[model samples]
Target: MARGCLLAGARLVDPAAGRDGAFDVRIAGDRVAEVAPSLDPAGAGVVDCRGLVLAPGFVDLHTHLREPGREDEETVESGSRAAALGGYTAVCAMANSEPVADSGAVVEQVWTLGRAAGLVDVFPVGAITVGLAGRALAELGEMAGSAARVGFFSDDGRCLQDSGLMRRALEYARVFDAIVANHAEDSALAEGWQMNEGEVSSVLGLAGLPAEAEEVIVARDLALARLTGARLHVPHVSTAGTVELIRVAKRRGVRVTAEATPHHLTLTEEAARGYDPVFKVAPPLRAREDVEALRAGLADGTIDCVATDHAPHAPEEKDREWDAAPCGMLGLETALAVLLTELVPGHLALARLVEAMSAAPARARALADHGGPVAAGRPANLVVFDPEALWTVDAAGLASRSRNTPFGGRELRGKVVHTIHDGRFTVRDGRVADGKG
Candidate 1:
């Protein structure tokens, strides 16, 4: 094998280091050996990165790999491939699987599967509730000490409704400095809801999920986080009210962080107008004003990062009537394109976008080796992309096993040209590398 690789002549955009200029980065082993204005290729394999932006690889704090049970929808290998293709070098796998990743064995299984994939680094999120049952706590300490070393816990598919239980969970997580991410929806208020509660839902005559449903839970969680002083993460912040709550909580010194999804930032409840099941999601799409608030929150630092909820389902499960279909849509492959096409330059600066998608998320998840500043001695976890490249989304061309992307058939800009993880090219020339070269 080549001793190292040389990425030549790329505009390095490392938000963590506040760098945005032309530079050549040399990789030796799995670390960046050098970074300069120019470097000779020597014996290293050279990739011409002219006209591309080389930045730290993206990180997703909320991705559903659906392994150990729902392999028909997605597996660690397939999901890692999709993440690499989308410029991500690391992703936090959600605990909501068929058997539920509530124990050390399960989380380790997921972690091992990710390593075997040899694409992105996968960190398994342990379940906060046993079997996501909401009644009892899972093996948080065990999972944390396990081989996966899970530092994030959540019952993403279901909210832990018992206030006492949630407080106890927060207190327990504080001992390990782990993050407890909540889905932030009250089952009572969002019960049987089909879409966001608004004019569109009123017109469509479908049951509505009110914004207050999310805001109430967030308020409660914020209070609990303040009481326990534990690290709390709110996943997929969707509503304007929730954004305001998070903003105020941060101002009050609560240990809280929030994330917004690409779909939630760009799409609104109006996408459900045609009753397309693909648009159905938990904490369902909110109003246009809510979308604006989410973007502003991300740009202004109230929202910490952008995470692709990246849920995938089988065709039979997602192609049914809106009310009958399951929530979630494919996101791993299209998150960057969607954000670049919809928010960059207009609503957010490119540096801020890079921070949200890469550095910020890695910081939130505490993945020290993933996000970067392209300095010597840093891990070679990086992505190179053409900011001006445009392409049309096609479900068949995606690496995910499901065909449930809402952006299918839509044109998007900023295609990923290459993705490197641990000094190996996982994606090259806009295609997944076979590792043979």
Candidate 2:
């Protein structure tokens, strides 16, 4: 479980290296020492990954690690464990904790917690608005310059609805060299909305949140990014219209990037038919057309990367009636399996999946020592998993403190058997391992 380990006979899918073949990857100290057709194990511990896929460790752009408060939902430690088990080596923690990661003090606290956990690299995302009220801006420069050095700012759970405030935030982001990630939901258009506005909502007699709510914000933010010259990131881009907006905006030379959640790419609004609160999520799942569009975007490089949007809510919060339940689902533990099951098999190539899950998101967040090419001089962060392994989801078996996963009881292909972070084994043989101590 230490740095001197060799992974042999695995199909190395390194999109950054543009290679997909059987290669032996060697880890020395904290960097990838060698990668070739054959490597000398010498005195290193060898892991025989004959039928597995070895790729660079993944990076998630959006994750809600409920720390500082609401630890019952998820903490940095628990979320890190879940992410490691799912093959992620770094994750950008969203700024929606109880006290709110609006200040340098709180973000630094979260950053230190991740260091102590010794799992994935947790990037603390500073809040864009004070207390997420959206009217006034938080101390952006202060948070950016603090010990955490937060580079991503967002009010993820709430949208900064004021156009003027949104524009100002973007302008400041340009000055600070940071990203302004929008939740992309227009409050006025989505007021009291329960699910996606479509035939299903009509049949169920439920108030629907029109896809326009998401698209409108995306369109406005694209223009705002263009006008202010700030880097804009759209989180959990739902609906076909929103995807189209991002596609067109990128073509028009807007400095914009977007991410699609696993649920949005795989599941649809049809899951709401049973009135199960587990299916309830903010920016509710859209129709099959939207799901297809999301998959296409990921395939065509229109969508930058796949982020879990790994929101965790307490049992009591999500166990209520559909209308009263909190809108979220656990994701950190199942993201890779879900994507491999849904996106692979002729729809997308293995290299493209590695790009969407690893390289793109890592470069987007500017996380160092991640998104590897599986070669010399790069930090050794990798995942080894059987591409054809099948398993059923079990909530009780998951590593998260909360069990709100909508994927529970679903069978999935692909399973992580080993995860390496910075040349140390955080998970091995489908179990958590600690080499730091």
lDDT of 2 by residue, 1-437 (tens): 44778899999998877889999998888899989999888998999999999999999999999998999889999999999999999999999998999999999999999999989999999999999998799999999999889999999999889999989988988887799998888888888888999999999888999999999988999999999989999999888898899899989999988899999989999999999999999989899999999989989988989999898889888999899998898888898888889889667877888888898887777776788778897998999988889999999888899999999999999999998998998999888896422
Candidate 1 lDDT tens digits, 203-258: 99999999999999999999999999998999999999999999999999999989
Each candidate: how many clashes?
0, 0
Indicate the residue-level lDDT of 365 in model 2: 75
Best by lDDT: 1
Model 1 spans with C-alpha error above 4 angstroms? 1-3, 435-437
Residue-level error in angstroms, candidate 1, position 322? 1.0
lDDT of each: 0.93, 0.90
Candidate 1 C-alpha RMSD relative to the actual structure: 1.2
